[model samples]
Target: MKLEALAVYEQPLKWFALGLGVCSTVCVVQGWQLAAMLFSLPFCLIWMYSGWLRTEPQLKYINMLFSVLYVYGIGRYFWLQA
Candidate 1:
């Protein structure tokens, strides 16, 4: 798809991903099953890939920052178990 189209779709996907990440965090904090850990992957993918499609420089930078932070938090969640 075109970058513009991707950028358009990115908003809803980002929201969904954020929701999933929040759910994953809740599950993790509550001592839930490890299966919930997998949910963060999709969140990270959507956030990072969507950031790549952003055309506006300012928005792209913001996206990159948020995406990196989200991915890092998710990554640390897993690493903390090790």
Candidate 2:
């Protein structure tokens, strides 16, 4: 795919990421750790990618950290389920 195509989708992806962040927040407020992590994993990933594309170190690293944490949380959730 061309970079132009990716550029076209950037705004939409950011909006979707925002929606995911809000959903994650709601899940947290509702005391749903698993669901929150599920939503947040994608949210963090999207923002991390966006940060990388935009050359924003702080945003990228912070989201990258959260992404790792969320992945670990999700993995642990399944690990314990097994």
Candidate 3:
């Protein structure tokens, strides 16, 4: 597998998602669920955009499910803690 073939996406959003994913992992391990979800927002958003751009129904639906689950987790852990 050549990296050149897989490097078709020439956008800053992918990099943004990567950075956020790393930070989100750190936040999760630190017990900062709210922050983790917040960080993951950009990553999920990018996937949603690319998923549609790629015309991939499966990718789009999976990303949609992940987005919903992420939001639900945030609400359940952060909002309901009160």
Candidate 4:
């Protein structure tokens, strides 16, 4: 990707990852498990994207693990409710 494109992509991902992380935390604190799970989905993806842009191995792996955890949370939320 071009420098400009990468820069643009990096900015939103940073803001979004932060915003979604906070939002997800709030959802859980408010006793909204499903909402937290849903919110974390995008948060993890944006984090992973940011990691990719910066070529950060640790960030990429951490976010990848979080994404899996989010997916499991989503599934468990529904599974237990049914």
Candidate 5:
């Protein structure tokens, strides 16, 4: 797909992006690099993309599981490194 063909934000996702962006920035600043990276990138991207694409509810549930895993990985990193 072309760069311009990407789905941009609607109301719900626009708000979600704003909140997640701020939280991710805080995590990055506090030395939670893994959390920040996961929250800022893959989690946010997956959430937004799936929402925008109107993916099936079951797939959205799977994405939610991935998000939970992302958070767990961040927690593990903090425990190991911090």
Candidate 6:
């Protein structure tokens, strides 16, 4: 895709990620660990992709780490349930 197309999506994607982060926070506060991690994973992934697109190493790396952690948390949650 063109840079312009990516640019057009950037703001909306950021907003969506922010919304997911908020939902994750609310889930955490409500003691819904699995739901929180589910929300967090996508939030992190979105930020990671956004960071990669913007060439921001810090944002990318941090979000990548968070994404990995959230994935682990999600798997762990399921493993424990089983």
Judged by TM-score relative to the true structure, which candidate is superior, 2 or 6? Answer: 2
Say which candidate scores most in lDDT: 2
Q: Write the per-residue lDDT of candidate 5 for residues 27-75, one digit (tens) a residue.
A: 9789877767676656556564665467557756766676777777767
- Candidate number of the best TM-score: 2
Model 2 C-alpha lDDT per residue in residues 1-82, reported as the tens digit of each score: 6444576678888999989989989999999999999999988888887887788999999999998998999999999999
TM-score of each: 0.55, 0.89, 0.75, 0.81, 0.43, 0.88
RMSD of 3: 6.7
lDDT of each: 0.68, 0.88, 0.79, 0.85, 0.67, 0.88
Report how far residue 7 has shifted in candidate 6, in Å: 3.6
Q: Could you tell me how far off, in angstroms, the CA of residue 4 lies in candidate 6 after the best superposition?
A: 7.8
Tell me the tens digit of each residue's lDDT in model 6 across 1-82.
7544677788888899899989989998999999999998988888887887789999999998988898888899889989
Report the C-alpha lDDT of model 4 over 1-82, residue by residue, as the tens digit. 5644766767767787788889989998999988988988998888787787778899899989989998998888889989
Give the clash total for candidate 6: 0
lDDT for model 3 comes to: 0.79
User: Which residue pairs in model 5 clash with each other?
Assistant: none
Model 4 worst lDDT window (10 residues): 1-10
Return the lDDT, model 5, position 30.
Answer: 96
State the lDDT of candidate 1 residue by residue for 31-72, as single tens digits: 764535567656656765765675445655665676566567
TM-score of 1: 0.55
Models sorted by TM-score, best on top: 2, 6, 4, 3, 1, 5
- Tell me the tens digit of each residue's lDDT in model 3 across 2-82: 433444663777887889999999998998878998888668877877777777788778878888888888788866788
Clashing residue pairs in candidate 6 are none
Pairs of residues clashing in candidate 2:
none
